[model samples]
Target: MNMIDPWGSSIIDYDKLTEQFGIKPFTDVVDDIPHASKLMTRGIIFGQRDYNKITDALNNNKPFATMTGMMPSGKMHIGHKMVVDQLKWYQEKNADIYVSIADMEAYAARGISKEKSRELALNEYITNYIALGLDVTRDNFHLYLQSENDDVKNLAYIIGKKVTFNQMRSIYGFNNSTNIAHIYTPLLQVADILHPQLKKYGGPKPVIVPVGPDQDPHIRLTRDLASKFNEEYGFIEPSATFHRFMTGLTGEKMSSSKPKSAIYLTDSLKDAVKKVKSAKTGGRESLKEQKELGGMPDKCSIYELLVYHLIDDDKKLEEIRSKCLSGEILCGNCKGCASELITDMFEELDQKREEARKIANTLLK
Candidate 1:
């Protein structure tokens, strides 16, 4: 089951909470609830969203920008696809896009070989992001590495001046017990939200970010700092959409390190098939047991992948859930079908990745 960050109030424990609404697991929870689209839409802020207040800003069309980034710690995965798809949606809705390759953040977090990792991260991110259909020239998108941008540094310093050690500690849960570096690093993230646009974009504009729930800390910190800065200096508007968390095949939050939990876009058909076939499930052990006791589609990680990431049709997803719960489809075969579907999807994505590499080289240069 997916867990919520205790400090994050807006985060709903999905695997647990979905049970309350009779929205069985492995079913399309989003589709079952009628008004859920509004309350639980892709861009709705997970916590503390003042929608009535923000709508005026959005309607006014006051210069707005959307930003999202990736840390090139490893190969890009379908988990990354979730956010990139969200970014493209916002761009289509008319937000100026600023995508960052977060080299500095990776160095701060991972302690990898700084220079080498930085280069790899940049190349990998540029290639994949462009492959995912980001058009730099046509869309007027800004693609840059975080460390290379002096503007980001200046913004970090400016934002830091307003934030006190106490405030940072409270927001980040840092204490006398925590490291000083950890307390301060979130500020760079806050700066990432606010800087690089004041001179160009000029004033408060709606910035929607499509990010997983774990990084809610970054969004929360950025929103708090932006509000403080706005009250003091009357600066840019800060807004974001917290996409619901997605779990890996093992029923935990998707992590690149655990190959079983996530499907990397670069994974070969064989690897994809092996991982999905072996993924954990929430079904009964025997056919007789499944017939008597319905399978828990809600808790099945493989089912969740098919619903959220693979199958696009609402009707078909429901049919699969009913089949699983009723013992019509065995878990092994169900997993095999999902694995094959995902493998096919990635095979197409890999071809596009090659095309993206060629274009990304030109843009990065």
Candidate 2:
């Protein structure tokens, strides 16, 4: 049925998601973007919904905003870096940035307390976000806790009247056993997306939410609600671009709850390097077999780390990929390279995190 639960930890078939969900191929309009990010140019960001609106805004120098949220239920992992990278790209493009700390959703879906959510959001997620180069201090940047934003809460309550229990059930697979808070949380997310379009925040501008494909349900719902309230609020439906998930070290979807599946941003450099070395690779059963059959970069978690974060040069990435496919490179060598790159990255992040933490603490105050 191609069902996707945003709260669930499941691996997704990207091709099936695009085919079943009516998400247009990002490649269809990638050329339309000016100075497209590597995520877009590469196949990492594979699908889109009305992304043309965003490119149009970028091209014409019109105002548009990018909104994304972090549900602070667990440690921020390397997989989460993709969103921060997108935010940095938008910031460079001069798009207004809105970051929502989805504390309410965290409490409802994860059984986390609001205080705990705030602590994790500030210390873990927001700190890494700043360290990763998103200028949260910019005037155009707006960061807020969902539980604290009255505008978001009120709008969610009012707009939620148009929705029903049946719709929530159908979208989220909620049954009678599902709690009321969990049922209402998606509405708050809908509000989180559409709130940036409200008159108080500068009315009716195109907004883009970069997300993983699993979050498609929320995007679809938010777009529908935006249309229904267009006359009343001058709401322009938000645009979205979907990126592929990073594979875990064990070849599953990388997740915060699964320690071995992820390299947490807070992980020590020694631990991060160890994890990279232990990661599943595309090498064959033996040296003889690998040399003859070549490696499968497509199946390697190490290759993904390179493509997604470590290696930014398209030519260099391609060279590595070609060598792997040609059996010119082996898994051990790739792991070593990846380890060095990660070491350099973590070293820099470690240095900046103290200042980043101080800055993060000052935010959402």
Candidate 3:
């Protein structure tokens, strides 16, 4: 299987899938097939967690909790969808899921007005999540906002007492010039992880957190704090992870701050088309150049998008790659197809999201 780093450089070892801080894929997910091996490895890193914890929870028929949260920054983007997909996967695996619309974090981090944050958090953000097929009616999933609860505040206080300024600096790049306020951000995130059970349910079952790799530092810090809490309190299962990262339209980082860099779920079809059409391509500088030098399918942002989200069928992806390398496909036309597909996707998702809002309102209420 072909594996590439974030820079699009080839990765040599599949065993890196089972790192100390990552998920360990099952052998069946990795054996023989090269493409599946690559995805299995991706899934492991993306679903960052200890393999044993997952097995133990499932074996004991325990209702292990899984979590993923998003701050109400703006509309839900495709970058966010990647995490949502992982959450759906965990739900399929019978995880008692907890999703938080972190309005408090948004307030603390962005200093937005409470009304605006609430609008984005409740109507826009939470509505979009259910639109993306999150099944909250199962009763196992808990959907709540962080700002509404005092338990999280208490947990944040306890976690803050345990974590040192030095450790926060190391993880968050805080230094002498850094405000002490930024140092407390990690504790708030930790509170998000443990708040569900503290409020609604508590048990010894394992916990899993599904998030983008950018959130890895938070999980690592939470894991460390949870261990310390276990040693001190004699309870609480350390949260394991399922790690993953999404490729941007620029072949780099995906951020909502860079609107063109990500496809938001709320984007109009025209907006989706425009963004995809203007996306960075890994093709040659010009048609002449592309024809003479054949494009770098391996490094193209468009191709990576297909690999990451669009092309669900692995075999079809291989064919597209083969055609691209053989100069049988044009980058512009391929992107045009991708643009239409994404625009269509957003249209359908928007409809489902409207439906999900009604359901979420009734069920959550």
TM-score for every candidate vs. truth?
A: 0.81, 0.99, 0.82
- Stronger candidate by lDDT (2 vs 3): 2
Tens digits of per-residue lDDT for model 3, 15-97: 45446335445453233322233335434343435546665565566667787776776776776666666677678777888
Per-residue error for 281 in candidate 3, Å, reads 1.5
Model 2 agreement with the true structure over 1-365: per-residue lDDT tens digits: 55789998788988888889899999999999999999999889999999989999999999999999989988999999999999999999999999999989988998999999999999999999999998988999999999999999999999998998988888999999999999999999999999999889989999999999999999999999999999999999999999999999999999888999999999999999999999999889999888888999999999999999999899999999999998999999999999999999999999999999999999976
Give model 2's clash tally: 0
Candidate that scores best on TM-score: 2
Report every candidate's CA lDDT.
0.65, 0.94, 0.66
In TM-score terms, candidate 2 sits at: 0.99
lDDT of 2 at 235: 96
Error of 1 at 80 (Å): 2.0
| Model 3 ranges off by over 4 Å | 1-47, 58-61, 175-181, 196-200, 235-244, 360-365
Candidate number that wins on lDDT, 1 or 2 = 2
Candidate 3, after superposition: displacement of residue 247 in Å?
Answer: 3.3
Range of the 10 consecutive residues with the lowest summed lDDT in candidate 1: 20-29
Ranking by lDDT: 2, 3, 1
**CA lDDT for candidate 2:** 0.94
lDDT of 1 by residue, 133-194 (tens): 76666554887777787777678878888788876655556668755544556776677777
Off by over 4 Å in 2: none
